[model samples]
Target: MNAHPDTPPASLPLFLHDSVADAVALSAVDSLAPLLGIAVKEAEKVVLKANECAAGFTVREILCTNETREILRELVKLLASYAVTKTGMATCMTRTPTLDPDALRKRFDDVREGMRLHELLDGEQIAAVQELFAKAEIAPIRFDTTPVIATRRRGLESKLQERYGDYVRVAVVDSAATAQALLREAYPVLLVADADEIVLDEPGIISIPEHAVADDSIVYPEFVVQSFRAKSAAIAAFVQLVTEFDERKTSSLLDKISIPDLEAVLALLAELARDESAHKVNLADTVLSWEEAINQEARFIAQTGGGADDFKAYLDEAVISMADELQLAGEDRDLLLESAYENLERGPPFEFSRAHTIRLQEHYARRIAEQRYFRLRDYATRLIPYEEAVNTALKRLFYLDFLFAVARFSHEFGLTIPEISSDGLGVIKGRNLFLVDEELKGGETVVPISYSVGSTDLGIFGATPLPVAILTGANSGGKTCLLITLATSMILTELGLPVPAERAEIPLLPLYLYRRKMIKKTGSFEYSMRALSRIFMREGPKVVLIDELEALTEPGAMGRIMAALLNHLPASTRAVMITHLIHELRPHIDLKKIRVDGIESEGLDATGNFIVDRQPLFNHIGSSTPELVITKLMSRVRKAKLRAVYREILQALEKERDAWP
Candidate 1:
């Protein structure tokens, strides 16, 4: 199909990605030329394993990063160009099951007499196979994935028995490397796209329709995907690590607190890698202060024990004495006294400890009983006036630390963090990149974060030298902003001015993408587990962009899987995963939220069309330079009905494209 209309003009300079080894990735495309051509040479019978994510008679909509399909198509086309003889192709990625005899036959005859679909397995009787393989599960899952396993088994066995009768030793290509030998060469090159659309619905076998207009096609956006606590914990850990690292590497002031070596600190940081239950210890002073306070209270409670529950009265007396001795004011002393009571009763709290201890059990219990009492009379405990001095300075204490610095900067510049209640929702933009194809160059597919009133600093992740970004949005709201002038800001950033903001931290990364293929959210895997696992290993400043992670699998399973992956990743990694399955991803990635440019309540209109009201082309799009035609068109469209009508014409043209072949 022709490129989407709103895709950036092909002539733009940012369209290309330059790696350290080469100036442009043109050779990267050429690299596949040979592989595709090779498939044409020796393997006339190709049993390809395509990961199809569609209903019947559908093709993948995303481009560039849907490498598995793209590479296979290239391989098939290249082989055809090579003039291979009697070529037969079979794929495992299909909307329907091969066991569905009628559907299988229909799929087989679709383009060629032997062309099969993306998912299939040929074997013994369909009834027997179905009974033997099916596991039985709920929605978004194929409980009986046995057909797939069986189909491959049967297909290969038939080939083995038929041998030459089956044609040129079938060339096989699948994500399952173990079965590679079942095909021709046994060693097939892998071609993959690093970014694509995140699935939207469960059992994402149903493909989402393209944007209503060619220019305003809806893609998803990346919101913070991690659960609140999970994300906070990760960010806390990251902040701790980075700040500590800076103290060591840059400040050297940490020399006073730094241990001679990790050996001097803990015997085996490496050994913990293999062990599951190892207790982790933190640096000195970080929690020691909190612990020491608890310990003092614990010792007093233990001493007062002996079924002499009335001894608890001594705790109050002791507190009174200490408060008077320290010359503390009532409020100041009350907090300490209250903290001490809780430590004696509850043993520990989320405020200071991740878990609790048994040795101090009774102390903690009594502390809980007298907890409110202390808080009630906190005014009376004239203890040292110290708490105020400690917490007086900062207000950004989510991690128990203040960030007046960030606040001051925002206030000074009159920048406001977008409030969820604000009229204008949020913004999503891409500066510049190579003028790829429609699904790519245009801002159709974006992984946007659910952001409130402010901009975030991000490291750049695209082909080296040139910047290319893929954003996925919610079903409707994200379509327009995906590209248009959003790309302009990216261009300005490349030109070396701050990208319309005060700070930006852009890093380089190896992009991995996946488009359509009903990705079932399994408890065992996050969306694109195989894809992420394959590429997540690359070290240093890499961007892991996923459009629809939750749409990849069942809803229940999607959350668990995404959580697992997020738990496994270090906080340093940068990633963007966009999907309509917001709840599923919010547990992992940070949100860059945006609201509908206009009314957002009506989901799909009566005609199965997206009903988001379009905003004027972003006047504030930073400095790169937006296409004049792009800006002009964005402002003119006012009616959803009109836009939908226009989209119909585009679809007609798209359908006509198929008539060409």
Candidate 2:
């Protein structure tokens, strides 16, 4: 049950306190699951749970990051050697039946009762009378001598014939010499006679002892009871093993994982390997083959109406097919065919024998039953002792699959464990993972941007970083992408997962919220205000990312609202607000409390794309640079008058740019 024994300790932070944070965290996981080669639902459940437990992590837990890394490394190495598939792991999951000890004991008792000789007696009396003897003297009949002794002997023979007639032959011989002759012929014979008259030294001959005859308490051999118990337990355990153990291969990068959890998985894997190597018996295959044979016979009977002729033909085909399936030949094939024919001749389903077809069906049923009882008995004898261990190991194998998936994700993405910061958040060379592939497809690499908020020093920002900042930039200057990158890094690090950054120092904040830019619509402004107001009300060390709040109202009023909101935010919060109304808002905000950062466009390149620096500049404001965009359009225009009009507008924009900042 303690599958995650080495999970993060109490000092680690979680970001799922509110629905917003959960949305952000889940979105991050959903985007990461495919990259990690795991199912989305599985990743969400495991990653979120781990993050929740990681809150309030102790110093020891923080130090264990290295151990987590080492475990992931080991998993990666193992996966490199073994190309395990989900289908293969599914095959390893065997279904074992629940073998209740009491039920098994009852079954054994029932079989034992059936094997008892007293069950056949039912208070019958033997009346012995004078009878002719061969090579023996008929002395004074001492034991219930009467003429009815022959009749009593015939009744006993009938009962024995009813019980084991198919598997054995019962003969009532007048003398021991006749029993010895039958034994010499190698016939399986159970001899029934008066104790005084029955005496044989043959190995194969079965006879009741004098004591058993006097007590009327003979029973089947002890091995039968023992075999029955073994088979019951083994079949149940085997069925469970087949059905439940569904661990898949793990070979990718994962978030932070506990060392104890990893070691536990390794131990279970070792135990399973050892058990498999030691037994060397293919019990599953044997069981399946017998089941297939029975199923094929049943279908044939159902289709052919179970005629004697049809059964003989089916048996002929079954022998060859079953022999190939079981890889048996010669005597083994002959023995199987002989057993089937013998069961057919045994007559009647013991419970329902009115129909000939029903009796034929019972033959196939009994043959398969016999096969399972013997084979499972042998397997169960060896497996019973390790039942508990095997079950536990299988359950642990499932945990192993989760770990492997996480490891493989981490490995493939080249994610590194981020340091847990007590103060601000900082990422050195952070790239937005969500855009990495798309950017690459466009023949351009993702520009890794480094930025910091709060007091964390990244050596690029010269001055001390403020806890609150207003982000401004030209259109398509990567301001929104930067916010997303920072948010992604924070959420991932908080969840104990590696981030898409070269180096990151993330605060262990219990709350994280990222609100994407909302388009201006009726009631949307009210909704946005309500959502943003909750951020100020919350009291904790947290991180908040908001984009384009100015779109909600007029520039002047929105600027005042932005200043008031930023000023009212708790000092414990680190926040970044992306907006184009900085010029209208800067007059109302306290310069000492808030910093301004910008992503500036450096005009157009030869391809007519904006040459922009994606990294934000600390303590600077950026222009929207509409004039440069207009200038690019002017070059593509053919009308002389339109071009002249653009030139005049550009001249006016130049004057405004020069006077604005």
Candidate 3:
């Protein structure tokens, strides 16, 4: 196959090279799979392979770059389509069992032996005979000797003799005498029948009489007559069997069996008859030996300048001497003579102008080229171990396709590869990466929150990086989103992929996301806490994400319980905990060991919407009071009693106004 002129060929590196040192699992991949638009099984494989840090990072960078990404995208789609086409072709691949070369040679030898009576003929005549024999289905004879068949054969012979011959004869002449008689004929001898003719009405046989010619020499006619004496002899031997079997009824009965079974049975019978039968012409053998045909054609091409007109003309004339030497007599010799003459008069034409000859040469040249091409094609198919190669190619293609998918994902999420950090993770202006489909959120701008662990922003918390942080904020004020952003960024970076942030520093740690499992059965909270304890104790510098501390137990007790859990966890662990009960847990956690962050709602807007600042307030002490909730709810309280209760809530807010700051 030729390469497309427009395409610049490139060989892409394998996505997962064996040289990679580290391979880690990213827990976030389950959530991230849909973002990449891949199945879970595929996503898992890609993520695991990509976690082989070095190569993953290199491949990811290569694919994620703007120019390379676009090129790979088109390449992937093209390869995918080609792979599908190959798959379809494989499904449609069918083969007919082939004969061995030796078997094919034997078949040709047999055919030649059967047609040997015609050896006296020219090359053109011999070639024609060979071609006709190739077409004949000469399986062993199973003569259907029903009355109907016999009658039909008789009628056919009668019509052939009547139409072609002007005279008829029924002679029991010997071979030499028969030849002598033919030498005496003036008019052409059309057909001759011996014992076979007797069965199909011997009276209808056709022949011509002897006549005198010039110079006391005999001139033989082109036409000859033949008898089916061999076939007649076989029929006579099987006369009892032929009489007993009714062809019509047997055929109808065989048709009642399933087609496949009937065919199998008939094939077995044919094979049996071929082994037993003596009459060769009655055989129904239609199997074309490809090897025989190819070898024969090759030999012919090597002769006579591959069928030049002069060579054909010479063969047509030269074959007469061969005919005169043949010992075959009577009907057999006549039949061969008839076929030879027929072939000489009209067979494959060789005469042509120089230009036409050149054209023919070019055509055969192209054909030879194509024949070699197919031969190589078939040889390669048989010789090469393709299963392994196909699998390897498919893996490469899949990797390319996946890389493109990630490119598109990164483009949509506005992602970039983050600077790797050994200590822990850090991010600046990081968006909520889990909210992959922004439009689904009804046009709400995804709040980009900036916070860090194992590193601190200089402006707010100074340069000292903390390994643990407590995120406390107003309900629905985006603390969970912020925590998710940090964790997701780290996960993506760890996977050697891009993070959805302006700037990020990530640690290569096994990440664990600790969230309350919502089990319908009772005592699930205790079970979850115990699991959390076991997870927290695992060796770190690992990062852990905790959401909604209240889900662990009763809200009033959760603050103390969470505070205890945080304090007991390994100091080497980096943790982010999102909780609403910040004030309750504050006194229990050692300030020197953890950083405190919060999402603050400055106040409500004129429309009663809280003007919540989505940014993380680093190193801050802030509480989300019920004041805004009560204020927003005041309008919805319609009953007079509820209004009075709302007034009391307002009066209490007034009393606490001095301590609001």
Candidate 4:
């Protein structure tokens, strides 16, 4: 069940801050100890795929990006506490190379020349991979360190080039690459301080002189160090956004600040926070407060007293109004308001008012988010100056002939870094939180083409959008790869990494991979089925990707099992499935089909086998007005086909339903 080590994957490293976030993450894992024990009772080959990458950074490095290290340590400790019969750790990383001195000057010049107006590419590739060792934490996994080292060095080359090389050439020629070079070294270190690993190495893979390799041919145009054109443009856009903000223009979205609403909300919160418990249990006091509350609409709290509904009703309306002020319209906005209301009803400590609770929670969540956001924003901001620096790095990389190699450096991790979001990634990976993609590498095919195979969207609108997708697609039709790509892509996206695609937007991560093969030893059809079932049934608030959902057994039985899965799947994850039971579970399948087109019956000839005369079809399902109602550009392409494809698809689905298993 091991995947090819060299598969290409673009992943965002997990941040395992060495503090509070880590404590929370570890505590969450500790919560699963009992559950994990139940799973390992009969299973074997226990694999704990943790955020080992974070562990890769030397402890000396300032660890504390969302408290990763302590969380990782706690996870390992908990796993050890589990007393699993057997277990191991594994990770996949892209190989990165490094360079130096005399090698430096040549790389500098090449990157400079390529950035000239027309040429843009990854700098000359002087690729090398190092031993990215994942030291034994309590002992399970080992990460690939060499690749990280290589990439890190490659990143730093620009800075080295600029400080010792030429700034004029860096600025005038290929600016993007020049910018990239300056940041490369620093980025890896950011990982060291922020993440669980350093898959990209420092001075490991850098742009050198194209002369070192050959001509501009060796490096890609995008990697050209002198490509300053785009950076200048981005600066303009940044300036525009700032100017608009300063000018109080609508485009600036400054209205979002809502000072008036904020004040109203704070006042409401203060009024609600009143210690109504001290007010009274006496009928006269109740009457007085009730009368006052009705007129003034003040929030009253009684720890075990009365008036729950009265307060809930009024607070609900207030929260709704606050949401409206924030411009949260439609369902999403409504849902947010409802959530705020529900949170209020649950009430905070007796000291805080329902309004105050909601306000504080809102503020705190925003604070936490803002804190996280600022960290990333800071990183991005620092990156701008480097865009200024790529020019020089490109020249160095070109001279060293490592351009193209450098551009793809960010994604060099041979293994797709699973963007595991909810809970620490270790839980999903070890506890069999169902996952689809592992060896999947549709790469280019999956992206630009938007080909999804056996893909199922498990999002529930009233609930969690994207439910578990139970996929069904023909073999060799890119079914497996599609599932893998989606599973990993979603994980990556959720984790906040730009996945390998034309463009991808998804949830965050601590991606876990569960191979169907691992559960095989559980033996019986029902036993393995239940074992797989157990994986999803464990603690949730996590996404599940199940491949060959039916391969566990009989079609009729599988249909029933799948039906149960569709119905019982955790409301947390948006699951997608890949199965051949498309026809069997057509009734249960609430997903669209992404199939290969060009199946000309004429082309089938004697074999009746499809001979692809054209590209694959990217067809989504459950998309009529309801689908249309839910869209905002994400489903643009799918929505466009709705006018024509909608009814036909509906009719086909109706017909297919009649023949379901």
Q: Count the backbone clashes (under 3 Å) in each candidate.
A: 107, 40, 12, 150
- Relative to the true structure, how large is the alpha-carbon lDDT of every model? 0.28, 0.49, 0.43, 0.32
Candidate 2 displacement at residue 193 in angstroms: 36
Question: Tens-digit lDDT track for model 2 on 1-661?
Answer: 1223243222222111221132222223332343334575554544434433433342223212222223233333333232132311221121011112333234223323322311232222100000100111111112111011111255575554333232234455566676555544433233444566635544334444423322111222212222223223222322332333221112111113233333333344345446445544342354355546655666767677786667567667765675565544454455555545556665433111124323333333333333333343334344434433433332233323323333444444455566666678888988876676355457468889888888785675543578888888788888878877776666455334557788887776534343442334334878777767766565655676777877678899999998898887776777788888877887788877688887877777898988889988777776565766788889789999999999999888656544543
Once fitted onto the true fold, the runs of candidate 3 whose alpha carbons sit more than 4 angstroms away are: 1-378, 381-400, 440-442, 456-464, 516-523, 623-625, 634-661
Best by TM-score: 2
Winner by lDDT: 2
Could you give candidate 1's per-residue lDDT for residues 1-661 as a string of tens digits?
Answer: 0132123223321211111011011111122122233332221121111112112222322111454334334423422221111110111111111222344333323322111210122333323222321211101111111001111223453432231121122333243443333212221111111225332221101222222111101110001010111122222322333343332233221122222222211222223223313322222242345456534664665677632244356556755665554344444455546644655554332133223222122223223222322321232122112212111110111111111122222233222221111111123333111111122435453233222112232322211121112232334444333332222222222111122222323321222344334344243344456566754454443333444555555786776665555444433443333444333434453222321111132234554444442322221111111122222333367888876765665555335322321
- Candidate order by lDDT, decreasing, is 2, 3, 4, 1
Residue 274 lDDT, candidate 2, scale 0-100: 68
Considering summed lDDT, which 10 consecutive residues are worst modelled in model 2? Answer: 126-135
Q: CA shift at 457, candidate 3, in angstroms?
A: 6.4
lDDT of 4 by residue, 102-141 (tens): 3223433332332221122113211111000111011111
Q: How accurate is candidate 1 locally (lDDT)?
A: 0.28
Instruction: List TM-score per model, in order.
Output: 0.22, 0.47, 0.43, 0.29
Q: How accurate is candidate 2 locally (lDDT)?
A: 0.49
| Candidate 4 weakest ten by summed lDDT | 128-137
lDDT of 3 by residue, 448-556 (tens): 7667777533233442477788887677788767766776665455334567788787665555565433322334777666656655555545567777758656776
